[model samples]
Target: MTDHGHNHKHASHKTLTKADAEKALNLVLDSVISAIKSHHNINITGFGSFEIHHRKAREGRNPKTGAKMKIDAYNQPTFRAGRKMKEACN
Candidate 1:
């Protein structure tokens, strides 16, 4: 199959290389992850917000043996789309 610039054209009429796009995406994702690790929330206007959600330890059932189990507490990263993004989707 032939590769293209995801059918997207830059304002300057230049198509971004796949590697470059991947690198850029990686950089952004890494930065967001680092911020979450630091307990900092990221809010990108017109894009979305990234934050961590904490869950307390709780009791759960084991599906395999139908036994009660203790679930450890953990922090989970979450994303909330901005107004602009939501509008764009609809």
Candidate 2:
């Protein structure tokens, strides 16, 4: 809801094209994914943090058949919003 002007540092706001915006977004997303793949946590001040959460294997039930199933353990990517972001949302 606010224009932070953080993305206009290199180019004028009016000069930003669709491709530029996509590229910038892709770069940020790629960086975050790469960090997570490397088992590293990313902390973006005033925004949030990205980390991996481990899920233990557990027994689950099949909805249709009412049968028991074994769920495999996995690592899940999680996000926790920073205080500033939460405040802004409210």
Candidate 3:
């Protein structure tokens, strides 16, 4: 493990082929994406919580035409780190 920059730690774990690692990553991310899409909140114990936040619609002006537009409200997922996970960075 070595420090690249901005306190980003890089560690060499079990050596795996690129294809194998990509497949595993995609599988894990897919599960997370699916869970976030369907559930309101997901708590990963020592990691953190991924919860959806609702954003209300607002009127905004277009840069090109300066025309007022109505924006549609939507839900966005946000992550909040837990104590154990937050301590790991330090």
Candidate 4:
């Protein structure tokens, strides 16, 4: 396959079709997202961990009007690399 900025290669013996690949990706993402919604952490060995981070409500400003506003509290999804993943990058 031609490089498209990503250098990673699949090590699997079987080839994956575009539709199959997308479906698999969506399944994995949906599972992780659901875990986040339940305030659970999704950890993948040698890859990374995903979790929901809580953010407190805060004051913010509008760029156009320079008016003060309140930013509502929210939960955000975040990821942290595992030790092996970090080491591989270096």
Top-scoring candidate (lDDT): 2
- Candidate 1 accuracy as TM-score: 0.77
Worst 10 residues of 3 by lDDT: 2-11
The TM-scores of all predictions, comma-separated, are 0.77, 0.79, 0.64, 0.72
Q: Over the stretch 15-74, how does candidate 3's per-residue lDDT look in tens digits? A: 655555556666766878898899657788988989899999999899999999998999
- Candidate 4 lands at a TM-score of 0.72
Clashing pairs in 1: none
Stretches of candidate 3 above 4 Å error?
1-12, 15-19, 63-66
**Cα miss at 59, model 1 (Å)?**
0.3
Query: Which one wins by lDDT: 1 or 2?
Result: 2
Query: Please, what are the lDDT tens digits per residue for candidate 4 over residues 1-90?
Result: 543211223224238655555566668879998888899999999999998889999999999999999999999889999999999999
Q: Which RMSD values do the candidates have, in order?
A: 4.1, 4.7, 5.1, 4.0
State which candidate has the highest TM-score.
2
Local accuracy by lDDT, each model: 0.81, 0.85, 0.74, 0.79
Clashing pairs in 4: none
Spell out the clash pairs found in candidate 2: none
Candidate 4 total steric clashes: 0
Which stretches of model 4 miss by more than 4 angstroms? Answer: 1-19
Query: How are the candidates ranked when ordered by TM-score, highest leading?
Result: 2, 1, 4, 3
